[model samples]
Target: MIDIDIRPAVPADAGAVLDFWKTAAEGTSISDDVAGVTRLVQRDPGALLLAESDGVLVGTVIAGWDGWRASLYRLAVHPSRRRQGLSRALLDAAEERFVALGGRRGDAMVLEANEPAHHAWAAAGYRREDHWRRWTKPLA
Candidate 1:
């Protein structure tokens, strides 16, 4: 595992985080812009986990807990930083946070087309549930 600074993202980090996701993340989502990120940090404060090394943004994961469910999203690592243990560290931090907050299961929203991400998630003890399908409707 390489040395990293894992911490929750603050409101000030919204822009950098959105920029980071452009290169690090696999796909796009509706709530991936500055306003959405700022709202997330303001609403939960601790949901967005960021990993920095040498004062640079290297990775991120959103460990969202809505007081009932643990939802993981946007698990991303810098292209140059992949295959290391950053994902593991971020996940460990997220999982620990969930457990501490009375969460039982930590669920992730993984893209089906992202095969590389599949290996990483599986390596972290996350499994896909074929029985469950996500249904979403954009409010906007």
Candidate 2:
């Protein structure tokens, strides 16, 4: 296994991140584009974390802290790199960031159809909130 390096993403990484997500992530979001990601990096520089093996992107996770809540999103690993502890590394960095920010709890948005993600999140000590329903409105 190659050594993995986890770090915060930069504006220049937006394109590569979008492309990586297309192959590694289970689903797409409206804000998965380059512009959206660039905005994220510019706004909250440490929120978007990237994992690289020999400088090639292998994993990504968004650990967003908005003063009150710590929300996680886009937790993805390269299909070829799955089950190799890449996700765990990313989550560790994310949770550490939250802890440093005085965050009490963290929430993740996982797609219901992505069973693989469900298991991973569960293994990481996250439980599914079946009683809650997600509501969204597209601003675009």
Candidate 3:
């Protein structure tokens, strides 16, 4: 097992997390901003999980539970840390969180074009629900 610390992100980590995402994560969303991330941490302290190795952030995943659903987003691992057990470690932590909170099922938001991520998610026991489609509208 990798000797790393897996914990919830704090308020001060917002900016650094955003910077990390730019390099490690694929694609982006409006909530990718520091301000938005700060708000998320402020609102739900345990939702954002960060993986640190040797005191440096290497991966992240949002295990959001809002009473009704367990939703995941922003699952990213650093390039140098790829092919290791970090992703599984993170997902295991996230799933444990969901079970602790009485979450019946967990769903992830994966980009359609991210083939590598498809393999990872599949390896993690997540399957594609082709019958479902995500609908979004920006609230500007």
- 31 Cα displacement, candidate 1 (Å): 1.0
* Model 3 CA lDDT for position 76: 96
**Model 2: per-residue Cα lDDT over 38-122, one tens digit each:** 9999998899999999899999999999999999999999999999988888998999999999998989999999999999999
Model 1 has how many clashing residue pairs? 0
lDDT tens readout by residue for model 1, 1-140: 49999999999999999999999999899998889999999999889999999999999999999999999999999999999899999999999999999999999999999999999999999999999999999999
lDDT of candidate 3 over 1-140, digit per residue (tens): 79789999998999999999999999999887878999899887888999999999999999999999999999999999999989999999999999999998989999999999999999999999999999999998
Whose lDDT is greatest here? Answer: 1
Instruction: Compare candidates 1 and 2 on lDDT and give the better one.
Output: 1
Per-candidate total of colliding backbone pairs: 0, 0, 0
Candidate 2 vs 3: which has more lDDT: 2
